[model samples]
Target: MSMTLALRRSIQTTPEQTATVFHGRRQSFCRFGDRVARLASALRTQGMGSGDRVGMLGVNSDRWLEVMMGVWWGGGVLNPVNTRWSGPEIVYSLDDSDTGILLVDDHFLHQVEGIRTTARRPPLLIHVGEQAVPEGMLSLEALMAASAPMDDAHRAGSDLACILYTGGTTGFPKGVMHSHGTLWAIGIQRLAQTPMPGGSVALHVAPLFHMGGMGRALVQFIAGETHVLLSSFDAREVMQTIERERVSDLLLVPTMLQALITHPEFDCFDLSSLRRMVYGTSPIAEAVLERALDLLPHVAFTHSYGLTELGSATTNPPHNHGAQGRASGLSRSAGRANAGLAVKVVNGDGVELPRGEVGELVVAGPNLMLGYWNKPQETAQALRGGWLYTGDGAHMDGDGYVFIVDRLKDMIVSGGENVYSAEVENVIARHPGVMSCAVIGVPHPQWGEAVHAVVVRKPGAALEAPDLHAHCKAFIAGYKCPKSIEFREALPLSAAGKVLKRELRAPHWAGQSRQVG
Candidate 1:
């Protein structure tokens, strides 16, 4: 069933059920569905039809969800614009997708004019903001008020659902094409991994634009759960929302979890209502995991592993975490593939590797994207033999739990020895004063590419490079210890919280195709 059908079912079964709570704004499923239908009708009335692309440029808001549903309802594809991207980057994605209508929130309205100057321009602009409607853009609220709820066209599962752009990479962003069936499989896989009762309240902390954002958000619709929304993740604010709304579940990346654990008021809030935490999109420090277990021992933690293309497919269920079986280190392991999916690591030859041996991780699944948008050659390159070449490197244990080693591109070869950045970064994160760390290969005349660590230290903490160097040396091979350490105020992260290694390594890789030999 389409996502819109799911919501309509929820409205019929539990009309009074709260659909979302966005920064003090709350709406029931009935109300939310009505708005979705009206907005869908509005887009349809504006000449949008099946297979067309609808663009939404906004931060987290109730309107964002409504607009997305409208696009899907009208049989158009939803293209959620990344708020962090620059104009040129945004223009490329918009133009590449051929987005004909743009639904924008206030903060990004300034980008609308630039969007118009692209080769082809959107025909209609609906400004979504609390502020008065700007001169040229149409008021989204006004349009919603003017339209009638649309009749559900009930699009097929094979129909296109969304176009997610990731740059949130090294090169120019590519639009990952995901379909309704892909999303449906994702929703079911995620729901089975974390069993939430009907009354569950989930926090919307991640950006709604990224894959992880909507992937988790779909869980709410599937379970008919209440979504407690936060416009952005501020540690204290999120803690307070959990206290106030009794948010039952939410997902956070390792960096975000660290910030929350370190927040001054972390202990001040009554967060016992929180029951489940789904974390991924990057590895979490072992220290941070220990800290979370200490603070909220009752909270079941789950780790999901997948990319935008796979619709966030793999999951390590709640049963595998903690002191129970973590003695096997399975708790920290990335986990097994989700239902309806296959994961295996392969060598440079694209041949599968033996179990427990690390190689490039590839996945084949119903959740995998049809292809990259409008890039057939790239599509053929990625989806070879029905398997999506993940470009990520990982290995599976004897028990079948998958452990992500590192990105294939980020793997460093020095003295003919393979070095995974995650291995070094994971060790560096053990440092008490280190908030987060990303390891990248930097050009070295002798070794070719030497291990370099870019670390973010805890606030007001004194941590010297030599101190960290000594720490890593104690646990890992001295060679794996960062040959050089660089400190940053904050590690640059994509919308999903994965460290942008391309951005991190850009300085050193500028003159070359990439740093490693």
Candidate 2:
């Protein structure tokens, strides 16, 4: 079934149940479904036809969900603009994808003039906020209220669903194309792994533009769960919302989770109502994970590992977490493959590697993306032999647990010896003074490249390179340890909480032609 039918089923099963919660406003499934249907009719009358791209640029809100459902219900494709991107990046995506209808809230309406001027063909603007509409934009509420409800387009199975742009941490973002069936299968797969609780209330704090957040929303919607959305990530708001709304299921990246547990007022909020917590984007810091486990003992912590092209590859379940499971090292893994997906580690030649061998991770599944939008060469290079070649460097254990090492491009080759940055970062993270750390290769005169580290010290804690060197030597070879260390108050992180190592390496190789050894 298509994503649209999933929402239809939810309304049929529980029409009067709470469907969305934003601020103090709430909507039931029956009302929400009618709005979605009306939204489809509204857009169809406004020139959005089958397969047309409709873009949304806003933070997480109930309106965002309406726009998502409305687009699919109208048989239109979604182009979720990254809220963190600059004007030019946004323009490039809209131009490249040929998006014709754009929706924005009060927060992003200010950028409309810039987008209108930069894009090759300006999109029809639809303002979704409660404030008065801008001069050139139509009001979403007006359209929904005036239009009549229409039937679902029933677009399913291989129909284009979304065009999500990558984080562009390394370079320009590529449009990853996902089909209705692909997204549907992903949501179903997540439910197959763990069933949703009856009348569950889910909290959405992550940005809807990212796959991690949108993927979670999709699964929750399919499971017929009530959604409680926040405008943005605020540690205090997250805590208060959980206590106020009795939110049962929530998704956060590891960094966000760490921030939440470490918030100054964390202990004041009664967050005992939380039942499940999902985290991804990057591997969890051992110290952070332990602290989270101690603070939220009743919450089930799950780790998901996947990319924009591949949906829901692996999930570390709650049973493999906590103090006992952490000792078993299973908590550090990316978990085994989910049902209906095949995951493997393969060498450069595309041969599958034996267990415990570090190699490029590959996934073969129906949930894989159709291809990159308008970039056939890049698409062919990424998708080969019926497998999506994920650039992650990982090794699987005898029990089939995947342990990510580093990005294949991020592996540091110092003096001809390859060093996985994640390996070094893990050791540094164990230091009592360290809050977070990222390792990258910087140009070296003699060694060609040297292992360098950028670290953030915990509040009121002091750490030195020599002490860090001693710690690393205890666990790994001296060659793998950082040759030089730089301390930073903070490091650049993507919206998904992943450390932007490419940003860290850019300055060091600014004048150099070669990047790798």
lDDT scores of the candidates, listed in order: 0.79, 0.85
Cα displacement (Å) at residue 474, model 1: 42
What TM-score quantifies how close candidate 1 is to the native fold?
0.80
Pick out the ten consecutive residues of candidate 1 with the lowest summed lDDT. Answer: 508-517
- Tell me the alpha-carbon RMSD of every candidate: 11.2, 11.4
Candidate 1 per-residue lDDT, tens place, 1-517, comes to 5777778789899999899898788899999999988888888887788899988989888888888888888889999987766666677788889888888888887887877775366447878889989878888788778998888767758888999986323334678888888888888888876778867998987888877879888988888888877788799999999999988898886567878888888889999999999887654556677888778888998888767777665777777776776776777677787777788888988999999898988888777888888778878878999899978778888877787755675566543234567667777887889999898887664455678899899998899999998887665555567888899898888999888888987898666423111
RMSD of 2: 11.4
Scored by lDDT, model 1 comes in at 0.79
Evaluated at residue 41, the lDDT of candidate 1 is 87
Top candidate, metric TM-score: 2
Residue 428 in candidate 2 has what lDDT? 89
